[model samples]
Target: MTAFILVAGAHTGGWVWRQVAAGLRDSGARAYEVTLTGMDGGGGAAEPGVDLQTHIEELVRLIDRIEGQDVVLVGHCYGIHPVRGAADRRPGRISRIVHVDVGVPEDGDPALKLVPDQTDRERVLSLARENGAGTLPAPTVQEWQRWGSVAGLPDDALARLTEQAVPQPLPTLTQPLRLSGAVAEVPTTGVLCTANGSSIAVVEAMVGLGDPAFQALADPRVTFFELETGHWPMLSAPRELVNVLLRAAAGKGHRVAAVREQPTHLRPFLMDVEERPRERTGRVDLHLPDADGPRPAVVFVHGGPVPAGARPTPRDWPAFVGYAQYAANLGAVGVTVDHRLHELTAYGRAADDIAEAIELVRADPRVDGERVALWFVSAGGLLAADWLAAPPSWLRCVAASYPILAPLPGWGLAGGRFRPAAAVRGAGRLPIVLTRVGLERPEIAVTVEEFVSAAADCGAALEVIDVPLGHHGFETVDPTDASRDAVRRAVRSVLGHLRVGTD
Candidate 1:
């Protein structure tokens, strides 16, 4: 039998792992729940001196008491810090690490540095500083719920959580992690919770565009699985969570360079894009309905002429799958494709890829062919100007979200030359839904206004969706209720205009 040690996140204790341990024990494994020194309310640890070192030492002591040779160490959220620190200290005793909802750590990274968004990072830093002593108070139950955890949990569960949660020591968040190269040799698995909308797939999409917070998933040794719940999977999704853990512990879930197996929730609607060699020119993933007659299809183009050294695989980004899945749920065939990122001919190559992708989708027997729509996001919108200018007869609608409508200073050689104003004159007569971010950079707004003026003057069919207070990458930056509602409305409007089914 294998020994499984569970480590809890900040402000919580081993109590959170009780249900998981019960599930594990039923499967014939020894499960040990760890309560860090300060968090377990013992040995004067409640005082202000608890830091990263204190928690790491606690885990080391636990492993020794168990007298285990092959240990499967599991960590959730903030618990990753100590779990990883201890792994570094005793690499020979650990067999595999399961990073649930949280992620594997890189040496020298403090907790705050791992947070992706700037606004949220600053807010956390401010909160830590406000505590006169080196500690940040835990959120009340209401605050935690608002922050998107324990989705669909019962009242009793919520009450138990509230009673057990405590303020986390600030030094743990501020202290840098120290690791030896030996820790990287251990196999690792990452579980992404999808109910909050920031699934592993969503993070990978940001990584495709070079988001540093998600770069860890790109590691070859890490295999990822998605759990359809909030951040607290053990509380809300114990059955599914436990099954995944059992598979990981048995060494059955390692995907080195393969297409991800579809999550159980998405298997009914989605089909992965076939994987090809890294040098393959173009690729697209498809999402379809069960009925299987010719269905309306919406093609998605992501933003980027990726920088010099930031190379990502075609199927790596989750936004493509997420949007495609969203379309499938709405009764439309959803397609997300990749285009060439050429520096000299940035717009030219990506536009050509879009054209090629549309041709392919139109020829597919599963797609309605005549009722196809195009969705362009960010820089990909700039590449799609020509398609919007001279759209095909089958093109019924077009939606551009936080798009770069016109060229600006330092834009590539062809950027200033390709004009949206001139292109609108010959554009096909189609309903164009343009979504603008209110809190975006000043220069982006200026360019978008220029294109809006040109499209309106040319008598083009257009409807504007202004996401006030939404940032440039609002969907992923921070999906507030208002922002999500705005994006959903924009998607619905585009699909409705295309006459796509919503069953």
Candidate 2:
């Protein structure tokens, strides 16, 4: 008799496997059902959020606890997450891994990026926010059943199933499965259920043949089975599920079986765009969405165009924390662009190209046709400041940090044609620069004074903040308390000037 180890899905305890275990035990096989963390009637793990690693740990414990020297691991729904993990831990001792009516483990893809699409991502995030007090939410047992096709189950079994459901930790669902030393090379079988004709068909199809993101699981060593039933096959078709498991345990090959309907692909056609060559165009290109009304857009045409591998990250004589997603999350479309070849572009060329990119963003639906702002750091900012001297009607706001060579000659001031104070003098409002008293360089102070003075003439709001501890890039290291404070203030100031709302 084989020792069968069963792994339950999300929000389910080991009790859900009782009937199947009994059937196997009656057949003279020892069956062990493994319950994941937070499902054994405990308060659930708090503080350090539970992730894929944590679930894998629990599974390892279950496998180690079994008295026999043999066991066949079975997983259902999210059970695939840990079953794959255990297989990697000990391949020799385990006989076979069975994924029962479950979504295939998506290897290499970020877990947080799951769900059907971006719109769904937003919905999930909204749900998480509503349930977990501004954090991620752990769904209740009742809630999870609603997500599946459970109406087809017999009333008696359905009632017991709900009673056995335990709230699962939200962290396990969201955390990306790190695969450095994690397991994947074990003999496995997928019992895919796709008869619901539901939106979950995507996930069902993925279980039959996992998504492209984590597609390495479809190797020759892996076996596939089809279960034509509702999502909860344990209650709806446990005999069929168990039969497949028995074949796997017996190490049999080519065991013919019946299924309601086989999965079919729509024969997707690929149109991947490969860039054709272009010679020394030296022009700006903007890509925007098609929509009515104003949309938020961010055009970042600021990199120094350093040769490949020469420059590691962006340059800030005084470093600065980059906010790539910060703008994207605020309903604004953010763009990151590399500047044209040279530092100085034929006098008026830089401004003109910047203007082009801005127009492209303004016309994009995702950007709401709103006049998007420009982002330039150091050298780029210096040029941007020079162009801001005579602003356009659509140009809503302008912001630059540690701008070029100022008249007063700051610590980083060098021989450059552009002066940092130029934008300050021309602006109706003041431009902002990152600075602090303790770490202040005399040259930076001069730069600030020059820009502040110019901003005063233009009647523009001028802000020269003396950041307490650091000069720039405060939030690069640990998401520390002090760094977060400084970055938050800086973000608010910039957004306020741009007339964008931040909640």
Identify the leading candidate in terms of TM-score.
1
The clash count of every prediction, one per candidate, is 0, 21
Model number with the top lDDT = 1
RMSD, one per candidate, in order:
15.6, 22.0
Q: What value does the lDDT take at residue 55 in candidate 1?
A: 90
Query: Which digits, one per residue and each the tens of the lDDT, describe model 1 over residues 1-503?
Result: 88999999877899999999999999999999888867864332245667888899989888887775879899987889889999988888888899887656789877655443334456668866775235555667766643344665777888888777876777777788999877888878888776543455444544454434445556666777877677788888888888988888877654534325432222221223333212122486677755568988888887665543444533345555666667777778888787775342456666777778888888889889999888888767776567666778888888888887765432323323356555666675678888888886654576788888988888888888988988766765645777767767877888897786553
RMSD (CA, Å), candidate 1 to true, equals 15.6
TM-score of each: 0.54, 0.44
lDDT of each: 0.71, 0.53
Candidate 2 residue-wise lDDT, 176-259, digit = tens: 655544355566676756543222222333333223432344354566666666567777787777777787777643322222
List candidate 2 stretches off by more than 4 Å: 42-50, 67-69, 106-146, 197-218, 252-503
Any idea how many clashes model 1 has? 0
Model 2, total clashes: 21
